[model samples]
Target: MGIISPGFFGRRRRDVPGLPPGQHLTEDFPVLSAGPTPRIREDEWEFTIRTEAGGAHRWSWEEFITLPQEDVTVDIHCVTSWSKLGTGWRGVSLDTLLDSVESTAEYSMAHSYGGYTTNVPVADLRDGKAWIVHQFDGSALAAEHGGPARLLIPHLYFWKSAKWVRGLELLRHDAPGFWESNGYHLHGDPWREERYW
Candidate 1:
């Protein structure tokens, strides 16, 4: 199962415009994780994308920071039913990273530093839809909030935005990750209320 917080059983969903169904607005950026937080040093951090054809494109912390960066202001929704709107982030677009790799794979498995994984379609990750964000709200993202770098796919449920993201493995078919294997929805689209199998 994914991160589950207490008090989720009885809260009423608010009928707020621009909010997903069955979700309520939240002003707090809650810290919920499947396990203990891993503290990674910046100097040792790296990101990679391994193609289905066995090709790998990698970047060290120094190299990644040198890539083009964008300021993104978007709304984020958590599977736990909390939605925070108009959050600010700065990072490199997934398009920029994918431009260097050549692959025909349609799926990807995002791997984080602490054994966490999540599957996302390559189509959902491209065309200005996603980013690998390192900063949140004008400051370095806190460790509890995915720290050095995290995948930021705000259009989907927050879980798709894997924190402490390390690399991505392009695959020929879709496969469930940590949460999906345990019965979470395969494609976690917040707007559609696709929260469970």
Candidate 2:
């Protein structure tokens, strides 16, 4: 795994002042790095969550949108060395989603397109540090940037905030995600600068 040094927290010339303290900024914000966006119809968009037992629930775009939404300000650290500070996002909390499904799993993983996945603890999920984001900077998410819905994890490295997130898979054990399997750090903590193993 590789370590990242985002030039945030007033460390970078372009750093903004809206984020909470101790948050740093990364060099670049690759809005379209994942490539061209996909064409997804609202009628076809579905978000599902499954427990290890395979018991699952699905949400149509309409149903998902019907859930309560909240405004959040979080710091993001990317594996590529860029941090977006004080990013304003509006979306449903993981707890809200879990409560909707009445989840029982103690741990969880988020899976997205491009074979991307990230492991997370239920405690993090319940802490309001994450969200199924629909809007960024007060605008609807663009596809290249994981539109429709993406997971926003403030505490962990940005990769943990999986983009183009299709659903969350509840797990009984912790499993490494795409980057994790590829030598990226398991737990990316910015304060200690723990970007890799």
Candidate 3:
């Protein structure tokens, strides 16, 4: 089943400052999920990075949290036309997590806890552009919003930031992920309004 949000066809407001083209500012964050929320215990949570060469980098929840953390404040735009501005998040940068791993892959497929997956360019995941966020709005992220951890790629449409992110598989070639295979844009740039294929 596809992810569903209540205001998918809500009226767009173009006058709002900082909103992308065809987007409206929203004060409340909406919950959209493709399936039932999985309740994962912190101790059982593990994140892995699998390389194209079949090597793997694994991090348990205990080890993951000890890494460097950064506080981020950025605007998030959803393909559904709602944009939330100045959202605060706390997480470890993808650069830090990927520093030791070596890959010539140009793309990555993010795997999430509840079987959600999204494709992203390796370049977009580096250089401090993305994060593995565990906290939102100064608190532990809520389960409905991908609590324990989620991939945060603010520059792209929100769906690219897969919720409940568990691991990332490096791919030498680009592959359409869950949404992309379902006709969502392969590169979901909010500014470009690349919502559908």
Ranking by TM-score: 1, 3, 2
Alpha-carbon local distance difference test for all models: 0.94, 0.76, 0.92
- Candidate 2 clashes: the total is 7
**Model 2 weakest lDDT span, ten residues long:** 18-27
Q: Going through the candidates in order, what is the number of backbone clashes in each? A: 0, 7, 0
- lDDT by residue (1-197, candidate 3, tens digit) is 57788768745534667788878787999988888998888999999999999999999998999999999999999988888999999999999999979988999999999899999999999998999999999999988999899999999999999998999999999999999999899999888889999
Better of 2 and 3 by lDDT: 3
In model 1, pairs of residues that clash are none
**Tens digits of per-residue lDDT for model 2, 177-197:** 777777877777765666676
TM-score of each: 0.92, 0.81, 0.92
Clashing residue pairs in candidate 3, if any? none
Best by lDDT: 1
Model 2 ranges off by over 4 Å? 1-28, 32-37
Position 169, candidate 2: lDDT: 90
Model 3 bad stretches (over 4 Å) = 1-14
